[model samples]
Target: MSSMTKIADIEAEIARTQKNKATMAHLCALKARLAQLKRDLIASETKKGGPKGDGFDVQKTGDARIGFIGFPSVGKSTLLNKMTDTFSEVAAYEFTTLTCVPGIVAYRGAKLQMLDLPGIIEGAKDGKGRGRQVIAVARTCSLILIVLDVAKPLQHKLIIERELDGFGIRLNQEPPNIVLKKKDRGGMNIASTCPLTQLDADTIKTILSEYRINNCDIMFKGDYNADQLIDVIEGNRVYIPAVYVLNKIDQISIEELDIVARIPHNCPISAHHDWNLDGLLECIWDHLNFVRLYTKPRGQVPDYNEPVILKKTPQPTVESFCSRIHRQMMKKFKYAWVWGSSVKHQPQRVGKDHLLDDEDVLQIVKKV
Candidate 1:
């Protein structure tokens, strides 16, 4: 039988099966089998589809990238036209955008590349109708803007999230504070600084064994669950920040608009009428978590125009800044002088190891 047929059979059986305390292990095994069958089905479909010409993949540019994803007829193309200079075809029909239409959004001295991607259907993650290609493009983006029609029910957001989730895109989530290190001889060593309420020892071993992992060290710095253990085993998951942009607010009532605005990371706006788009852009900027730094000469004023923007990290020291300018500067660098939130005193002489903060002024003096 075909892979789809087999998958359907397994799913049907799983649905028919009942749950009980004694049948938990049986259910787990069946679930694992179902997961394997689904993976096999997806693999077959992807291989049959071969290289697709959905034609949306484009070269990434600008300081950061924002990928637009949603079902068709949700004003994604129109929103792209309004927000950026790109002229994506907008029509009163489905699939007007057949390829990737890229545009630049220059805001606050930071240039953000916004891509208008083709609308995805329900099964896009399963290599259906360029879904894989579109999501692959999204995997590279700094942020995913899930555009939704306010006229429609809000549940569509969950559907879109499920598709992204199946493709290993964990939106608005951090990498789990769990680490799994492989070893040769040790059976399994589990360590935790905090109590783990979401998982137990037996469940952890079951998950590890399902992945054919025999010996490893599992460390949990924070709370985690069984799915997280699977995620750690999968190791191909991408955790990205996502924003839910509610479009077509002009069609809704003012009272309805207030309710939409209350949603987390949600911006209610009209893409057609350009209402509250500035607020949407501001939301995008904040979610990016950008760090902008200015550079100064030894005795001259700092250049405020061309600031070096970097992602925020735990230790954003001078080495991180120097590597951006030139890698060789690290060896020839003597010390750096900082004058901003990262420093205690004004114009403090610091080394390459000195951590930097946003808007910090830096001047590097090289060795003679």
Candidate 2:
């Protein structure tokens, strides 16, 4: 029998055996067999790719991909190393990380992929010192983290800012979160005294009004905390998410930690000391807004526990996501069985337009 037929038989048997105490154990065994069959069917279909399950599920890509950019020696490599298990060379000297290194940051049960691009300096977009390559990397990333060395002179910051503007990469809707690294260096604490959270509206406007952002359609992967900055960079329409890491905190005092906390949408961590790293990961997961769900054949009661993560900015529809599972599934899709927050009653069939909320189990039925 086809998978659908087997599911229907199981459901019918479950109803008939619901009141028979002597057969309850057998009924449960049948249910387990039905669940396994459904799983096997889904796996086979998914393997077909594109609608047919030939490896076309978009959810397989994991959470959003984010890119990191900043001036050399701003602790970008160190932060990346701490957040992800991958070891990119972390040196005290400038320009240590020459290429982009991608790593996964696990947060609150979700995994967010972060990319550490080569350090960018003033005039990078104009092909000065690998600026072109950095810009190329930025173009493909869903979100960009601009690392700033607060210990450096104001002139250095301006040079980096001017180069970004010169490259026409400043998305004016949301400004990048400026991560101040090495706060303990030379006993300098610029951000501590002049907190980013304390910046007035005029100051923020003046800071971002110059750049002529060229790419408007790019989508960045980050947590919701970065909404403000992403909106500024992408013209208020695009949602770019990011998490701010105040690295080298071990060298600083509790007073410094308090100051870092005060900064808007910031997470403090000491890569060397491994302090508050879990908190940072939690923040990253919250930012991504990911949800988990499971799929099975129609007419079979849905399983709630075995779910796969589906990364989405906002929740998507069952039909739309079914297409992501397999292109052929989309073509043959007749209806869906849904279970979640949006469903008002017991498991039931839904039309193609039925919207799906987070953690909503789905069993898509298609006509052969």
Candidate 3:
């Protein structure tokens, strides 16, 4: 039978069992099984490039992708809708979002794309209720945003952390920023004792600096031991750089906000109230090391006055940088003229083998 028809039948059975405890238990179990089947169907459809399924291929488009992850009903969808132009369904129910929704958030004339993935549940990695599928989506993203309900119990928060671990999605590297939702709700003050909140900024900076210097050009080939893997990917390289955004600040008190602010790298905001969005945007850019660079006309003299951001990458060769501008630029079979600290002459021409450094300006003269 069709999924809709099956759901209808299950609903009818559930309604009929309202007075019978034994029948209700059986129907509820069946309903849960049916829901799992529905989720599997959705996952299969998405993998095959169908409309009903979430478009996973959207990430391959070279957009700076961010993934949203957390347990059910943590306001991830609400934050996604507020940050991007997407109209994702926002409800208090768990697992309301089954498919990933990709949306674009424009900031300061640049567009950053983010993905709102399905909610993760306990034991998600081992084929538990859309857990495996969600982890697959998270693997492809450049950044992961881990949303947490601050009002929820500590045990609940730890459940999410364990789920991430179960899926082998590393949070410490490209580690997801903890977005503490419902900060306004009066609850047990978890922020003060939060392990993440207790992290010192200076210590974080020191660790990041050491990480950059040591692993600047290191590349892993095949599967290594877990100890080696941990040593290699535990820092910023494997993990997308992240900044904490304490969402739902309008619901919290000043004292609470102050405690949250004291956290090493927290940015408070109210996604529902549309507060501090710009600050969040700025933080995202800063964390991502994203720089805006405008293109200039071929014949027109290059403007040295306007600043163009040259993003730092493990490999910043001419070939890689040129490909970013346009694949055709690389295919056109021409050399690039480098102008900056590397060359003494004005607009010094360099071959395709040239390596570009941060803030180095270039004028590519292609062979049409």
Best by TM-score: 1
Provide the lowest-lDDT 10-residue window in model 2. Answer: 51-60
Between the candidate structures 1 and 3, which one is better when assessed by TM-score?
Answer: 1
Compared with the true structure, all predictions reach lDDT values of 0.83, 0.57, 0.59
Location of the lowest summed lDDT over 10 successive residues in candidate 3: 188-197
Deviating ranges (above 4 Å) for candidate 1? 1-49
lDDT of model number 2: 0.57
Better of 1 and 2 by lDDT: 1
Worst 10 residues of 1 by lDDT: 21-30
* lDDT for each residue of candidate 3 in 293-362, tens digit (9 for 90 to 100): 3334567765544434445555366776677766777878587777666567757888878766645667
All candidates in order of lDDT, best leading:
1, 3, 2
Question: 226 in model 2: Cα distance from truth in Å?
Answer: 24
Candidate 1 local Cα displacement, residue 358, angstroms = 1.4
Which sections of candidate 2 miss by over 4 Å?
A: 1-62, 105-111, 148-239, 297-314
RMSD of 1: 2.4
Q: Give per-residue CA lDDT, model 2, range 1-368, as digits (tens).
A: 78767866886887877545455345545544544454455455446532221211112134567677677887788878877888889887888987767788655344567777777766564346776556555655555565544333245545755555433344323444443232222432223223244233333332232222222222222222222432333342333554555666666678756755564556666656777768776666666556666776555666654455655645677766776676677788888877778689757679888877777788777687
